[model samples]
Target: MSERREGALDEATIEARLKAELPAWRYEDGWIRRTYKTAGWKSTLMVINTVGHLAEAAWHHPDLTASYAWVEVRLMNHAAKGITDKDFALAAKIEEVVGWQPGAEGGPLEGTPTDPRFAYVKYDR
Candidate 1:
């Protein structure tokens, strides 16, 4: 029998949280998932590495599915055998780091150029 975490969220709670907190993420089949589309292989690798680093730092790992132009991140508390606060927290951090756009914010750090030749990520419009 799988052990559930103390703070395991029910389906309704998960759905509500996903909608309110992580609009791009969805809960399905016992996991919260998000797919980030990149420019190509290089960007895909970058995305994977970034997620890896964040997961390591947070000590909460996620399952990643990658292709030449996209990466799908799925998060679930394996030990708990259910979606928990840890999963939601990690997912929120990943979403923040992965989707950051300095250029659009007019920050000092210019994000990747808009030119296709130098573009890395396909930011959601």
Candidate 2:
């Protein structure tokens, strides 16, 4: 069999890593993908901008799809033509930032109000 690209993980390794590290993401069609559900259009745009900023800063971009209330992010190392460390790294960061719930952490940052009218991301319970 042809060897995988350098720094690219085998499917088994990728699966294990995803299960252990990023439960919200899945391996599919040669890429690692995650879908973040938002409260509405505003939240969707916020998520897109956040992902864009991080991807640009990391210099590893993901293919994004958005609807009225959800955004899907798919990451792969195009140069390597496989799933590499970069994909996992960016996915982890995206999960961390997008899933953050300061209110649940019991800190000064109360996070967004619970009212539906002001809700942003539909945080995972």
Candidate 3:
């Protein structure tokens, strides 16, 4: 269910809404970021696959990075060029597939990805 609030929603409002509605993604700077910890590279691969399904379902994709045990996700609406209700709304659905939270420690991952952290994870499945 969606909650309606008065006034124009900004970063704080959008972030807050994402936290409550999504319950998994945490608000950051100008976007929503979520990190996943896996057991190994293989597990990370699977996690990437799962995220693919999540992004596809939401129709709102995120900037993701996975190396060995960590998969970091960033959500933002590029078309709109800033954080908007649509961005958070999509983030909420993405959270349903992969758990996320604001201010919650990712607890670190075992390995790092071959490329830079901003590198996106592409999944066929």
lDDT score of residue 52 within candidate 2: 99
Count: clashes, candidate 3: 4
For each candidate, give its TM-score against the true structure: 0.93, 0.96, 0.61
Candidate 3 TM-score, true structure as reference: 0.61
Q: With candidate 2 superimposed using the best TM-score fit, by how many Å does residue 60's alpha carbon deviate from the native? A: 0.5
Q: How far is candidate 3 from the true structure (C-alpha RMSD, Å)?
A: 10.3
Candidate 2 residue pairs in clash (backbone atoms < 3 Å): none
lDDT of 1 by residue, 25-98 (tens): 99889999999999999999999999999999999999999999999999998877889999999999998899
- What tens digits encode model 3's per-residue C-alpha lDDT throughout 1-125? 03333423466577567656765567676567777666567767767777778778767787888788778878766766566666666665655444432214456652234455433233212
TM-score computed on alpha carbons, candidate 1: 0.93
Q: Write down the lDDT that model 2 would get.
A: 0.93
How many residue pairs clash in each candidate at the backbone level? 0, 0, 4
Model 2 segments more than 4 A misplaced: none
Model 2 Cα lDDT, one tens digit per residue, 1-125: 03588778889999999999999899999999999999999999999999999999999999999999999999999888899999999999999999999999998999999899999999876
**Candidate 2 RMSD to the real structure:** 1.3
Residue 112's lDDT within candidate 2 is: 96
